[model samples]
Target: MNLRKISTNLKLPNYALAIAQDYLPSTFFQYDFKTSNQVRPAHTDIPKPNFQEYRRKPLENPNALSSESVDNRRAIMSLFSFVGGIGTLYGCKAHLVQYVLFLSPARDVLATASTSVSITDIPEGKTMIVKWRGKPIFITHRTQQVINTERAVNLADLRHPETDDQRVQRPEWLVIVGICTHLGCVPIPNAGNYPGGYFCPCHGSHFDGSGRTRKGPAPTNMEIPTYKFLDDNTLFIG
Candidate 1:
């Protein structure tokens, strides 16, 4: 064999390299029975397999998993939105709950038909405020005091005394709104310079027992909401 110079920087061959087959032991490196002892170049260890393949299951698009996950989130959100819509509707509707009670909406500004009241519930000479047609109607059962005064008023003393003849129904009964048309105020009944009628404190308006505007700042008389007698004693106002 030809003699060859060895690299000085490299580790000197172990004299036992000729006998060595397994990887060198630390304590064994001190012995020398020289032969070529160059180790094979160190090879780096391979890493574990990535799940990138399993994530992209066969027959599915490469990006299908991520896309489907996003779609599922949106679908869940849409289902929640539909449930909220129904909840909103259920929260808003109102209705009549009983013969005299109602399930009123939390919000105001309602459009409703006429409500009815039994005449027998109220008596002579007394005025009852009942809701009719969403407005307050003052139903006055002319006490003998009011009736006696009506007969006593002189026609010459009155501009429009609002006689029973002017009413659509019987003259003895007076049905008029409690609200003043001039400025939407509840008028005081049968007092303060009124002979026997509705008086509005807001504008000093006067309406006779028949609700005919008599004297006041108001342009029209106390409103007579549209109403019908369901029977001799029950009146429906709208």
Candidate 2:
């Protein structure tokens, strides 16, 4: 039972050397060595697991479901996923609504969207200029003679034809946007070839007293803004 000599001769592990040193029972080694050579139990002879223990048991509550079917579990999970997705979309929609409102025009800007002018301030046969939406608006007080002359012009002679009566909201008032249709230049009031009309110096466009394109490169008449007379003296323009 000399452990150092046994270990050196057998080339056993350190644990085997410690066992041989600590456990000096020769009977244990002898019996273990004999049993190693004898017929051992086959793998099949080992007791099989009691699979019955793993089998599902009945629910303790009489009203409870005994087992959840595969389909039932899938249905529950699908319902939860659908509800979660809808909630996420609703949350995103709320945030998008806030962003849309943030980009809209301010209340003050919308409030000042229109302009008001006193029609009485403009003398007869004269033109007055006012600004609306960053564009010049022409408010002309036409004399009866000028109106009669403009109405006398034939529609066939004009480039963009329209009757003089159609251009004015009233017979005395001639309101139009001052931008020349040819090149977006401002036209000179009462200075064109046509009497008491508009002239675009940039491209030689001529407009008559009714703001109709009488001559030059202008494709159409001067634009008329949305306006109405609140009273004989008050005019509202947008």
In model 2, what is the error at residue 55, expressed in angstroms? 19
The residue ranges of model 2 lying beyond 4 angstroms of the native Cα positions read 1-102
lDDT of 2 at 1: 35
TM-score of each: 0.46, 0.62
Displacement of the residue 59 alpha carbon in candidate 2, Å = 19
lDDT score for residue 93 of model 1? 44
Total clashing pairs for each candidate:
5, 0
Candidate 1 C-alpha lDDT tens digits along 11-113: 4365534334255454554454345778765456556566675652332455556655776667778999999998877665432234224455433434456
Best by lDDT: 2
TM-score of 2: 0.62
